[model samples]
Target: MKIAIIGAGGVGGYFGAKLVKAGHDVHFIARGEHLKAIQNNGLVVKSILGDFRVANLRATEKITEIDQPDLIILGVKAWQIKEIREDIRKVLHKDTVILPLQNGVLAADELSEKIDKRNVLGGLCRIISKIESPGVIHHIGVTPTIVFGELDKSITERISGIDRIFKSAGIESTISEDIEADVWRKFILICVSGLLAVSETTYGELRETKETRQLMIGLLNEIFLLSKKAGVKIESDFVGKAVAFIDTFPPSSTSSLTRDVWDQKPSEIEYQNGSVVKMGEKHGIETPINKFVYSCILPRELKARGLR
Candidate 1:
């Protein structure tokens, strides 16, 4: 299959490298030094699973240079969705399928509204990865599953074909019958964890402290209730499982938001915790913990943008 990975950052770089290693026709769309490094030396992925290189892979900064791909992995940050959507539309034909691996629940819906719903797939990634440097991606966790499926829960031929490609490439993927629930399940943990970790400045700190850990559980409970009200039936022990997972992480481990805040880079807080806050208001649900977390980061976000 001719595959194109938009935003060759951590998620894209890691997954695309795997597919290319399996001898698939993969092209990466990137920019700046990352693009330069891939062009000069190929994309480097350093992981505990294994370290490998894709030397002959095709990469470009412009979308016009590539042909319509069988699959497009939308791995850009949530904030870049609008600009990337416009660029992606230029190369997408009727048969091209878009798999948005961004965080939160709105990405697929927003993209589907712009593109055809039949061509958009809802996906959620479970991995702890980041770009350590130009041309290099670092995988920090063991969970590497990418769950996705059709928005309407149909078992179509395209879903099977994509699943086959992912499996052949050594990726741990599942084609969910109800991808919406899958997306919300991940969101329940990510939104709460991202908020708490960013507010505390470190995941380890939050995990180690009894008070903070209890607060984390509380925030998660609120998110769970909100999800139920939204008509998504999550697993019964979802919060317990999520808490257990967080406890296993390194004490000093921080979320992508904390890293972005420290580096003064743009963040997805507006869509992460901020999204929860908005949902809470809409549903008449009181999300004090989430609200406080969002308030704590709002100033830092504004300062990063020079609005202070």
Candidate 2:
């Protein structure tokens, strides 16, 4: 497959390296020091599964420099999806597939708005990884996983082919029966991310503190209600499953959203918590807890974007 990875940070860098190692023609679109390091010395991936390096990488900062790709793994944040629409349109072929691996639930729909919906696939990834440095990707935890399917959840030739490619690279892969529902399932896990950013409670602290736990419940409940309003058909036990999964994390574990906010970097706040607020208004649902979280994070996010 001719693959172009849009944001070659942790997610793109790690997965793109695996594809390259599997002998796929892959190009990385990155910027600044990361681009320099990969071009000069290749990309290194440190993983518990196994560590490997890809020397003589095919890399460039512009998508236009890439040949028309068979597949483009959209690894940038949900918020940055809009920023890359024109670049993607310029290089896309009719048969080119776009898989969005953002954490948020709205990436597929958002991407399809700019491109043809037939070319967009509903996708999400499960992995804990980051750019350890300019040239290095460190896989910290989780079995790196990719769950994806057509928006309508039908099995097709390209879906199977993509599945084969991922498994060939030793990634845990699944083709969803109801990708919309699965996307919302993954979204439930993100509730704590922005909540922790606002509440500033450790996982242990959140579990022990009654007030914090109440706020967490409020956050999850709002999403569940909104999911129903949006007609996404999320499971009845959504909140319970979300809380159970959250409880399994270590005390010090914090989401990328919380960390990004603390680090004063632009984050997925608008698409994460802020999306809940926006969608609630769209669906005529009330989301006070989500609203509060989004409002609190907006000032910092604006400052980070230099919009404040």
TM-score of each: 0.96, 0.94
Give the 10-residue window scoring lowest on summed lDDT in candidate 2: 247-256
Compose the digit string of candidate 1's lDDT tens values, residues 65-154. Answer: 779898999888887787678777888888999999988889987886678788899998877788889999888775688899999999
Residues 154-223 of candidate 2 have per-residue lDDT tens digits of: 9999999999998998778999889998888778678678888877876768867999889988888998
Residue 97 deviation, candidate 2, in Å? 0.5
Q: Give candidate 1 regions above 4 Å deviation.
A: 306-308
